[model samples]
Target: MLIAFNKPYGVLCQFTDESTGPARPTLATFIDVPGVYPAGRLDLDSEGLLLLTDDGRLQARIADPRYKAPKTYLVQVEGEPDEDALAALRRGVRLKDGMTLPAQVERIEAPDLWPRNPPVRFRKSVPDCWLKLILREGRNRQVRRMTAAVGHPTLRLVRWRIGDWTLEGIAPGEWREVPV
Candidate 1:
């Protein structure tokens, strides 16, 4: 079974009671169908589409770095970006680990999208804008770190697409089973 779940912000990726305390829910509660695991992950603070599957091989294909699947995000940054900053993101920025591969970065206006439950901070002087970043990597906090490195700190990070899958119209915490 291939389940495309719209993971809510602040929820752990796995079906682990170990990490989540009393109130926190895992994939176990949402997906009653057994033998499935998440293909990759959405950080606790991130809200987006997550693919889950019962077939281990299919899961590997989606999640594995060797496959080079492009994951796209709508990132809210702290300022009205200058072209230079966008260029740096396109060229690639160096982090503590190393330099990231070049990404497809574009500036966009914030849409009339659904508001996050606990909305991001408001800095009146610092206007925010959206960025579409498509990358073939899954490094820890990569998008957030990269934006900050380019001098535009990230305010919100939402993964809208992963390879051919997308969050689309699926509401937070909803899931749909699609074919392989």
Candidate 2:
């Protein structure tokens, strides 16, 4: 079985919180399916679609960088990017880890998205814009890093699609099972 969960912001990707410290929300709060694990991680601050599966082979296909399954993000950035920045993202960007693979990137009008709780901060002086970025590789905080490297910091990040599956009708904090 495969599951697609629309993870809400501030929720940990893992099902358990091992630490005895202050509690933060986790996948357990939204998902109750047994024998399934997240295919790839979404950062605690990011809101988006997270795929889970009980089959190890399916998990590997989705999570392993070698498979190169595309993940698409709708990003709200702190500044409007020029053509140079867009081209740089399309070509590739040098990061602390290594050069990122070329990504499919384009400027987009703000997506009609559900309102985030507490919401992203607004700045009058600093203009913000939307970007659609598709990457085949998942790296730690990669999207945020790439945008910052191009002189535009990400204000909000949402993963809309993974492989052929998408958030679609799934609302935040909800999960739906699909056939593998």
Q: Give the lDDT of residue 38 in candidate 2.
A: 95
Tens digits of lDDT, candidate 1, 1-180: 899998877788889768444767777767777788999988878888899998999999999989999999999999877999999889989999999989999988785567887889897887889999999988899999999998888888888888888888888888999778
TM-score of candidate 1 against the unseen true structure:
0.94
Candidate 1: minimum summed lDDT over ten consecutive residues — where? 19-28
Which regions of candidate 2 deviate over 4 angstroms?
none
* Candidates' C-alpha lDDT: 0.87, 0.94
Q: How many residue pairs clash in model 1?
A: 0
Q: How close is candidate 2 to the true structure, as a TM-score?
A: 0.98
For candidate 1, the per-residue lDDT at 57 reads 96
List pairs with backbone clashes in candidate 2.
none
Tens-digit lDDT track for model 2 on 1-180? 999999999999998888798999999898888888999999989999999999999999999999999999999999899999999999999999999999999999999999998699988999999999999999999999999999999999999999889999999999999766
